[model samples]
Target: MQSLTNRQKRFLKSKAHHLNPIFQVGKQGVTDEMAKQINFALEARELIKVNVLRNADVDAKEAGELLQQKTGAELIQTIGHIVVLYKPSENEPTIQLP
Candidate 1:
């Protein structure tokens, strides 16, 4: 995934503002199952927020990188315990990033 421009990042940040974390990285860290689910979510939603549990072995940043590597999604940012990801859809893309 390519790096997002400031404008694109701002656009995505606003779009993600109200989204809840549908995926969570738990104590087990970024497992295959989690990566699969994340891929599914990205395929469906294009953008998603992932919550990193407090007791998780990996920090939010590490978990974000792991997910990025596994799912080939772009890591928008890791804020607090939240990891935000975005991947432009292969078919019908929804986000028209500036």
Candidate 2:
């Protein structure tokens, strides 16, 4: 996956700040189904946030990396149990590319 430009990363971070997570990774971490769902979400939204449940032993960064790998999404940021990812939709995106 291509890395987001610094400006794009900053813009995405600000845009995502107010939105709630669309998906949650629980004690099971990320299942194949969850990965598929994430990929689908990325195709639609380009940018998304995921919540990692407290019971999960995986660190937030690790979870972020795993999700990025599985979904071919960029790891925009990871704070606490929340992860932010971005992947340009195949079609033109409604969200501005920074």
Measured by TM-score, the strongest candidate is 1
TM-score per prediction, in order, is 0.95, 0.92
Clashing pairs in 2: none
Runs of candidate 2 exceeding 4 Å displacement: none
Q: Model 1's lDDT to the true fold?
A: 0.92
For residues 1-98, could you state the per-residue lDDT of candidate 2 as single tens digits? 66778998999999899888999988888888999999999999888999988988687899999999898999999999999998888886788774
- Model 1 TM-score, all chains together: 0.95
RMSD of 1: 0.9
Clashing pairs for predicted structure model 1, backbone only: none
